[model samples]
Target: MSEVVLITGGSSGIGKSIGELLTTKGFKVYGTSRNPEKYKDSLFPILALDVRDLNTIQQTVKTIIEKENRLDVLINNAGAGITGPIEEIPEAEIKANFETNFFGPINVIKSVLPQMRKQRSGLIINITSIAGYMGLPYRGIYSASKGALELITEAFRMELKDFNIKMTNVAPGDFATNIAAGRYHAPILNDSPYQKPYGNTLKLMDAHVDKGSPPNLMAEAIFNIINSKNPKIHYKVGNFMQRFSIVLKRILPDKLYEKLLINHYKL
Candidate 1:
C-alpha cells in the first residue's frame, strides 16, 4: 500500500507544491487549509484545518487516521511571516506570529504523535526557515519563531527515537511564494527611529522573495527525505549563499558575522 501523508498549509505555496509532487509519486497525500472550499481542484484532498485551533488540529488528524488506518508521514508546513523592527512591532502581533509559526506546529505534532506511535512507523518534517538560523534586523520576530521550532525538532527527534518515529527540520531560504502578501508588516512610522533602515530593509526583503528560487526546490528536497532509510535530523534547501550563511555564522566571530549582515542589509 502507498504511504499516507498529511501536509499542513497545503493550499498553496511550498505546501501545495510538495503535495502535488508527492501525489504524482503515488503517495496518498492529504493537504490542509483553513478553508478547504477554495481549492476545489487541488491534486490531492484539501481538508479544513487551522493549525492554531487545537480542536481542528485534533479533528483533522483523527479524520486522516480513520480513513488511512496508518498515518505514515506528516509535514508541519503551516507558518506565517512577520517583518518589522523588533522594537516597533506590537507585542500582540509578535505573540500571534509565534502562535502560528511555533506553537501551532507543536500542537499539530502532538495531535499526530499518538497515531504515529500506534503505527510504530512514521516521519514528521517541520518546515522552518533559513532566517531562523540568525536574527535579521527587521525580521527578528519571524526568525525567533521559526528558530524556536527548529530547536524543538531537535529535542523531539531524540524523544521519539525509541518509538521508531523520526522527526526533522527542513529550513528553506526565500522562495517565490505568496508568503509576502500574507506576512504582517508593521507599518513604517514616519517619526520612528528605525524608519529609514527598516524601510530599506523591507524593500530588499521583498526583492529577495520576488527573485527567490522556485517552491519546487523545497518540494523535491522533502520528497527525498521521505524516501531515505534514515533521514538526517536537519536539512536545508536554498541557494549557495543562503545555505552558506549558516556556515558563516558558525565559523566567523560574532561581531564579524554581525558586520556582514549589517553590510548586506545596509543597516
Candidate 2:
C-alpha cells in the first residue's frame, strides 16, 4: 500500500508543487483547499477545508483515514501572509492571523496525533518561514505566527519522539509566490503613528520578492527532505539573503543584528 499524504493549502503555490511531486513519488497524495472547486485536477483527491475550523479539520482527517486506511504524512502547508507592523494591525486581525497560521496547524497536529500514534509512525511537515526565526520589521504579525509555529514544531518533535512520529519544520525565505500579490486576505491594520515604517518595510519586501527564488527550488528541497533516511527537524533553503540572515543571526550581537536588519529593510 502506498503511503497516504495529506497536504492542506495544496491548491497552488508551493503546496500545489509539493502535491504534484509527491504524487510522482508514488504517495497517495491528497490536497485540501478552502475552495475545492479551484483544485480541478483529477490526479489527486481534493477536499474542502477551511483551516480555521476545527470541526472541518477533524472531519477531513477522519474522511481521509477512513478511505485511505492509513495516514502516513500530514503537511501543514496552509498559511497566510499579513504584511503590516504589529501595532498597526487591528486586534481582530492579529487574533485572526494566530487562528489561521498558528492555531490552524495546532488543530491538525492534535487531530492527526491519535491516528499517528495508533499507527506508531507518521511524518508531520510544517511549512514555516525564515521570519519564524527572527524579527522582520514590516512583517511583525506574520513573523509572530511563524514564531509560534516554530515552538509548536519543537514541542511536537520532543513529545512525539518515542511514538516514532517525526515533526519537521521547513523554513524557506522569500519564494516566488502570490503571497505578496495584493491579495484580499489581510488582518486589520492599526492606525498607529509608526504605521509608516510598516509601509516602507512592505515596499522593501515587495522589491526583494521580485527577485526572490522560484517556488520550484523550495518544492525540490522539500522532496529531498521527505526522501532522506533521517529527516532533519528543521530545513532552511533559498537565496543568499536567508543564508546571510542565519549567519548574521549567529555571529552578530543583538544590537548589531537589529541594526543590520533595519538598515537592510529601511532601504
Candidate 3:
C-alpha cells in the first residue's frame, strides 16, 4: 500500500505544490484547507481543516486514519504572517498570529502523534521560515512565532526518536505564495513614529518574497526528506544567499549579525 500523507494549508502555495508532487510520486495525499470544497478539482483529496481549531484537527485526523488505515507523514504547512513594528502591534493580533503559526501546528501534531506512535514510524515536517532564526525589524511577531515552532520541533525530535518518528523543521527564506494576501497587518497609528521605517521595511520584505524560489524546489526537497531513511533535523530551502544567511548567523558575532539584517532590510 502507498504511504498516506497529510498536509495542512494545502489548497495553495507550497502546500499545494507538495501535495501534487507527492500524488504523482504514488503517495496517497490529502491536503487540508479551511474551505476544502473550493479545491475540489485538485489532484489530491482536500479535507476541511482549520488548524487553530482542535476539534477540527481531531476530526480530520480521525477521518484520515479511518479511511487510509495509516498515516505515514504529516506536513504542518499552515501558517499566518503578521507584520508591523513590535510596539505598534496589538496584543490581540499577536495572540491571533501565534494561534495560527505556532499553536495551530502544535494541535495538529498532538492529534496525529498517538496514531504515529502506534504505527511505530512516521515523519512530521513543520514549515517554519528563515526569519525564525532571527528577528526581522517589522516582522518581529512573525519571527517569534516561527522561532517558537522551530524550537518546539527540535525538542520533539529528541522526544519522538524513541518512537521511531522523525521530525524536521523546514525553514524557507521566502516563497511566492498567497501568504501575503492572508497576512495580518497590525494597526499602525497615523502619528506613530515608526510608520515610515515600517513601511520601507514591509516593502522590502514583499519584494524579497516576490523574488523567492519556485515552490517546486520546496516540493522536491520535502519528497527527498520523506523518502530518506535518515533525514536531517533541519532543512533550509531557498536561494544561496538566503540559505547562507543561516550559516552566517551561526558563525557571525551577535552585533555583526544584527548589522547584516539591518542593512539587508534597510532598517
- Whole-model lDDT values for every prediction: 0.96, 0.83, 0.92
Q: Assess every candidate by TM-score.
A: 0.99, 0.93, 0.98
The C-alpha local distance difference test score for the whole of candidate 3 amounts to 0.92
Q: Is candidate 1 or candidate 2 better by TM-score?
A: 1
Candidate 2 segments exceeding 4 Å error: 182-192
lDDT of 1: 0.96
Per-residue CA lDDT of candidate 3, range 37-60, in tens? 898799999999998799999999
lDDT of 1 by residue, 1-267 (tens): 999999999999999999999999999999999999999999999999999899999999999989989899999999999999888889999999999999999999999899889888899999999999999999999999999999999999999999999999999998999999999999999999999999999999999999999999999999999999999988999999999999999999999999999999998
Model 2 TM-score, 2 decimals? 0.93
Model 2 scores worst on lDDT over the 10 consecutive residues at 182-191
The pairs that clash in candidate 2 are 88-189, 88-190, 89-190, 90-188
| lDDT: worst 10-residue window of model 3 | 181-190
Root-mean-square deviation of every model: 0.6, 2.2, 1.0
Question: Which residue ranges in model 3 land beyond 4 Å of their true spot?
Answer: none
User: What is the TM-score (0 to 1) of candidate 1?
Assistant: 0.99
After superposition, the stretches of candidate 1 with alpha carbons farther than 4 Å from their true spots are none
Q: What's the C-alpha lDDT at position 100 in model 1?
A: 98
Question: Residues 141-190, candidate 2, lDDT per residue (tens digit)?
Answer: 88889988988888888889999999899998887887787332333346
